[model samples]
Target chain A: MAQTSTLDRGGATPSAPARRPTAPRRSRGLPAWAVPYALLLPGLLVIGGLLLYPLYQMVEMSFYKVGLRQIRPNPRPAEFLGAGNYTEVFRSELFWSSLRNTVVFAAVTVALTLLAGTLVGLLLHRLGRAMSTFVVVGIMAAWATPPTATAVIWKWLFDADAGVVNWALGLLPGPLSELIFGTSDWSGRPWLNSPATIYLVLVVAVVWASFPFIAVSVLAGLKSIPSELYEAARVDGSGPVTTFWKITFPLLRPVFSVLLVLSVIWDFKVFTQLYVLAGGTTNREAFNLSLWAYTEAFSAPPKMGFGAAIAVVLTLILLVITGVYVRQIVRTEDVR
Target chain B: MEHVSRVLTRGIAGHSVWRYLLNSAVVALGTVLAGSVVALLAATAVARFRFRFRTTFLILLLIVQMIPAEALLIPLFLMVRRLGLYDQLLGLVVVNVGFTLPFAIWMLRTFVAAVPKELEEAAAIDGAGRLVTFWRVLFPLVAPGLVATSIFSFITAWNEFVFALTLINDQGGYTMPVALGFFTSQRSTDWGGIMAASTLMTIPVIVFFLLVQRRMVSGLVAGAVKG
Candidate 1:
């Protein structure tokens, strides 16, 4: 019932042949069975070679001691170090803290993004058409802004000196500002200096950039539900809260689940924004798994195998998180 | 405003900035063109045919999509180097294509399914060969979805920072995002110039997003609903 199908049919009508003759499917140079395989060959090669093979390589490298020398064109033999890299990663305090950062950030971001996004989606559903379009356009701009630009803009906003955040805080009543920060003077207060404050800024930036897609998606889901359900609930004397819990939430559960999983996957691996906010590996305290892996592998004195171990650990965690959802999707989809 | 404009002018007029912008554009365009073809073909196969391993392929696409690109970074970096594509734009393009293909194929499958199979059947009945029917009937119908996927691919490639940062070490090969990162990390940072450059980088993505957002949303919803 989506607009895309209607659009596709309408677009195809011009070129679609009118006469319906009765002829069987013909096998020309290629057999009918071979056609799909032919089409899929290029994609299979790319995915197999680039994605799957690298995944195997990452796991394989984790079991060996790969270094810059081992990975060079004229490579040295990598020594097998069964579980050595993993033991190094597991014992390291940095890995534990980075894992905590990754998990906590993802948990907080996924929850807040869903809450804000669903609220905006409901608001959009209730608004007038013109106003809905206006708000959607505004939200779309936020969603479409590149992650790097988003991080930079937020960084500038929270800059210690001459930032709008401090300026606005200073404008508050002296007593209020004093109560909040223990001083009315808000200038030269570094927001990105500490891991806590850095993550606060990051949470704000990430949630701002991400919620729009969820909002738009939830809005589309909302539109698909029959209004008659709401009407029937109204007739049954259901309160707005009851109606939402009983009807809206249940109807949109599938959409919500998909969005939640996708958000978790994205937020857990947040690198670019953290890279910008933490200003590279300088503030090791703010490192997430993605950034930690990158720094470990690529920075001076590269520990390629150690980084691969971290990445493998991260991937395993994500797989555990999404395994059930993937199973459910495969079960529901009639891919026979 | 005048001071801001001066800083913006300085930022926008840098030769290195132009090179970065061009690099970004080339990589993004290459991803779009190459990704669309690969995805479109794969999507058609998954949607239209009941081949062996079809379900497994679908599952693989989902699994690949879920894996963080960062996880593959080290090995892919090595792979690119082994293939003599390191520090090259072609290498970046190939990486982007690989990363973007899973989502594109997954999303485009829904678009392909949205086109009624009867059209192809009708074309076949009219003595049109399989290639003819696919080219004449299926491709046009899938074009809108292709646009949506291309836009997604373009934006993803444009904004990609990590792979580009790690893969291409040469200053001349740096993309816009990498250039912007370098700009921010400088000791004497030009805030106004950085802000201006960031805004410049964001404009194209926003414009394209706004143009097709409605269709894209519906397309996304359709996919989610079907799944």
Candidate 2:
């Protein structure tokens, strides 16, 4: 009764009802159904206008043969050709190489990030509080860095002439350097000179940039597990690896699932770092799906329609692969 | 780090790094403010009130998170140009806010829900108005979550490259990340300049992360775990 009276207190007290939170007023205000929608209007407008509408436009453009001339205020009109762009893309060697590179890059980076993250997460769980906080903060500094900056740092650190990485390699004996890298000198060995080596630096930079988030997330997941489970495993004399697989792995399934899907999406579409490392669209052979799409759309003599087609295909591929995870996330949200 | 500061201070391509930093600040701060306001209102509505299609709204947010910014670049370019915001910092701000809104709302919803419902009632019982109650009681409690979400939005805008690269064409309009691209080219190399500028770009992000990282852990987990 008291709650109802206060909630229903009329608009008579103008000052006190400053923001009469369109709260539950079964008596005679706006319908309850309208409130959430009203509040959500701004967000809905932005998403609908910016995200959904553009996506629709992207899909529409994919069916046409539009380019720089077509996109101009006054120019040649675009011609709709159901799948001509897709056919051209499939036939192009550039597309195949980008697809192959993207797949390989995503596969390797996801695996390394998960493995390293989980192990670090476990280490964080086992460590004393101060030490764990110290290590987690240290790694997060890397994750917090902008992607372009990370690429530049790694590129400079691996510079052929005056880089610290090569300088460190020089400190090793000639025979050791030869045995390890199949080379006697690190000088003038361009990390960015070829597709294979650019990916090496790229993989290192991305993994270093990405793993900290996974590790922190895994740490958060680890903290949620009851120590009793670990204690029980210890009493059962289970080995470290055994305990990990039998106990920890089962406990962190959800976190791992979420991380796996997110990492795949992130790595598959990785653009900035790769763009910086490859030194722009200059190196066509090293493009990933995202970069290839960008270069196609915005590069010289922009093939806007063709670029839209690539983006659509990439989205489709991502949808097919990650559709389950997306559904899972939606399902989790449905619980409320 | 020293080299990075030197390059940034000396300027790049005859353009002052400070100018680019100011542009980035405008976009990032604008995103944080605009994204947070809309997200907070929506989050409060979702968390505190029962409404039709609530589940659908939440689900839509998750789907939006999955869509890559690159996929929407083509039409967005047209949209921005048509809106007469082309080559403007405000355009970048709006797009960043749109991209970051779903995330900010989702993360903040959990924090909003964490605030005790009883407190709001207590404040109202004291003859406080709805807005007053929220400001005096709710805002202080939810500030951590707000800070966390705002930081994420800020970083998203600050480091965004693809949209910044595509939307603005003028050399003077460059954001820091896009500006870094100018130092490298096909025929020439400027390792010192690139390294110096890159390090300067990274410092602010790290500083901000350190400030709210503790909340971010819980904030991240909350978004993932909560329905």
Candidate 3:
């Protein structure tokens, strides 16, 4: 009876040694969901305190009659001008023109980037490994260059006088005099002064600076595709174009969509390129929303409230685009 | 040989090349170092701890990232001015760290999490302390992540222009971006010089990426596909 009792206790794990095994596991505690949140609190607080507060202040400023004068002590209360600033902004012809320009710029830039990126990605897919590596390096190099530097380089190249572009144009088959010194002499035609020309120049500069990023991202997407798909397609006697259209394109659609949405948001808020290229002045016709906001805030009399309103609008636009994109990304992730 | 000769003749050279190289190196290195420290700490915390508001923090980070650098210029400028850091490398570093911290942390977190918990547990069983376990046993496993995140931070800080333009005023303190701006305003806007400057600016980034591109590619693929 004593032997049987000892054996049962050892087997059933009612003794101290049996409990010891479970103690370590219990000591670690549950996979506490709260712990992750606690860890995240500090970062969240910092972002909220710094970024979100300023954003809130901007929103508050937009609804009031605030300006350069308001930066100092004033007797007059910041008048609760409900949507007055928004109304003024919406009614302004400059505002409308700038809005149109912004839309056009974002659309064109995103379209060009996606198309160029996709083509480059396809090329990388088809090319030999050595060549692909070389191209990838080149693309990364371009992507990594300072935007301001690229802007400067592009502006120099497009300069009317003693510019490399003009010099090259002088060599092309044409009336050399006409090409270099046209009826409207190249030097006389200020590229930055004309609204249409300035827009084109800005587009070119932005495209050159941004396309490399899209290319790299697309390349990443391309690399994920299994090689067997290509083999399967080839066995079915599908041409290269058809194979890409059916097999590769479908697989890459998710990444392409995400890239498209991100590029749109990014392009819409582009300020430096426009600011540098335009020399931080409104051309009336060429100005975009970002430049418009900057001008409103920093120009004479300094309508900080109006500027804030414009920024608010821009933020809302970005938020809406991001929301849609995030939903799509989340849905795709869930499905997978 | 003709192409080489043409490039040499037409490229930005002489005194400007040295200046450009110096400016870019200073800004890139300073920003990268500052940004990496913040990223490393934040990423480790996020990976190791399970606290309340973790999801909110992640979401907030994504949102903040969408708030284009352009939008932050006014606030950042005001803050910098108030802090008396205007036109300084320290100021640039602060802003670069702020701008880069979110993405760096996000990227680094994945790497930190990729490390097996059992390794740390085994180290603990061997009487190693938490810090010792982290530093000695787990650090090497996430070395690739560190490289990847650092590359990102370096690239971003190096390429930054808007805030640098708005914040930096003194030519003596100018970074590459600001220097490029000055180059733009100089008489004649030398195309060759500008191109040469740009080409030079692009080189270090290219080299860095080349060195780590394989690791980055594999890391990204593993994280996205496998996760």
Candidate 4:
């Protein structure tokens, strides 16, 4: 939000640089931009060293044949295989299936989380201060918990034989049990084995993990709307739903769009839940691209180059998602 | 409540819960303490100064936020191993601090900047030193920001699975995430036990957020709106 206002303010300042003493002075020895650039150097260096270089190495490794053989003391001659790794990835059924699963997982998770988050946000907003504090705290707790621990907890809850979910389901009256389990035997089905089941479980876990941020973001947007707008709507004899449709929803669109794009990008890269849920080995078809790439890199003799290729592909997808998010945020800001 | 309690207690033994709690606390506390110090100093410098590269530094911090932690796993692991930090809690703390510093600085900078500069200037005109002005005049105003960012840093560090899995090998030294992984085996995963452990693990984070949520909300709105 400040990005738009800050740019406008930044433009106006250059016209009257002489008026404000606090304004940055251009020294004779150094160029005007040098001060700001110099302040930025340490941060730039750290990011370049820590983030950019590794990214570069990943791209390079994707094209070269480097693995256990390359780890040897003398090292074998590494050859540029061009897009051989990418070609091999495209040809592999595991890669295609995982990519498909990843898209489905991300899309479904974003949809579910957005639905849950928006409802909760509106609930808390309507409830005003009554249940707001308690609900907010509960949501934030889910948001803050470590993913590994959360994954473990959900895994147990969904356990076939001894899990609370199945135990609770069994408590339901009559032939519903027979319908769920088939016959009176009534044991729960293995959830992680089937692609459909695993996909559903992953979606639920990811939604639970991510929804709080959306709720809070929406809540923030809700707070920004002047109360006078609602008061004016009420004076016109508008019902609650109509008032929300006409006034609240339109104002929240910018924030909602931003949250949706962020959730999509975040959900696509999810690894911990799927990786843990599958117990490190399941239908490779059920895996997302992140886990698939990880297994490729570190399982057995290790296909580092191939893994790097998958990682590169995943990175490109993330970049595309990010580009869309930035463009939408910029465009919406311009409209305002 | 009774049914929930029964479900929680059914399969979990006492010793494992205690062990898991201990491990989680150690990792979480170490990460928060180390991360806060780095974030505080860095945020203070960037917020208060008008140095040449300040804008560049801020932009760089934003870009760093975009790089996923997964991408840095291998390089960080290698760096830690080289430093003889592998398998140690200290190593985990170091890495968590490094990972959280950019966010901490970015978030904290907004709160620090929001403190009226006039207050600090008044203190300075009265012949107060920079350190005194910061400690007496500025710190109190920014305390909420510190709490919010510290909670964020703690959550990120505590919840992290990838780096913990990569760096630590000894079960005793393992953080909660890696320990959770050990619940699964070739034969069958101990679903009940895993769930109970996970539920237990989530409790502290829940409590921590509950303690800080009000402050966190204000802090987030202030930071984002200001930025």
> Top model by DockQ, which number?
1
Q: Per-residue lDDT for A131-210 in model 1, tens only?
A: 99999889978987888999998999999885899888767677875778787566778998999999999999999999
Q: Residue B198 of model 2: what lDDT?
A: 76
Tens digits of lDDT, candidate 3, A1-336: 111222334434433443334324423543435434444455555466557766777788788876655654343566789999999988899888888999998999889888887888788877899998888777756665667766776666667775566667656565655756464333434567677777778888888777766776777777788899899999999998899789888988877777788789889988777766776665667788888877777677777788888888888888888886766556554311
What local lDDT score does residue A250 receive in model 3, on the 0 to 100 scale?
91
Q: How far is candidate 1 from the true structure (C-alpha RMSD, Å)?
A: 4.9
- Please give the DockQ score of every candidate, comma-separated: 0.55, 0.53, 0.25, 0.23
Report candidate 1's interface RMSD in Å: 5.6
Off by over 4 Å in 4: A1-46, A72-79, A128-130, A168-186, A327-336, B1-27, B49-59, B82-84, B129-132, B186-192, B221-227
TM-score, chain A only, candidate 2, equals 0.89
- What's model 1's lDDT at A6? 35
The digit string of per-residue lDDT tens for model 1 on B84-202 reads 99999999999999999988898899889989987876655455666788899999999999999889889999999999998998888889998888888883256777887787788
lDDT of 4 by residue, A114-156 (tens): 9998888888887768588778877777777777766666666
**Quick one: ranking by TM-score, best first?**
1, 2, 4, 3
Tens digits of lDDT, candidate 3, B1-227 = 44334434543323344554566577767877866665666677767665555555655666777776655565666567677888877787777777877767767787888898767655544444445666898788888789888887888787787767767776666666656555656634555555655566666777787788766655543333221
TM-scores of chain B, in order: 0.92, 0.94, 0.85, 0.87
Task: Give TM-scores for every candidate, taking all chains together and pairing residue i with residue i.
Answer: 0.92, 0.92, 0.82, 0.82
Candidate 2 ranges with C-alpha deviation above 4 Å: A1-29, A175-184, A330-334, B1-5, B124-129, B186-189, B225-227
Sort by lDDT, top down from the best: 1, 2, 4, 3
Better of 2 and 4 by TM-score: 2
Cα lDDT for residue B222, model 1? Answer: 62
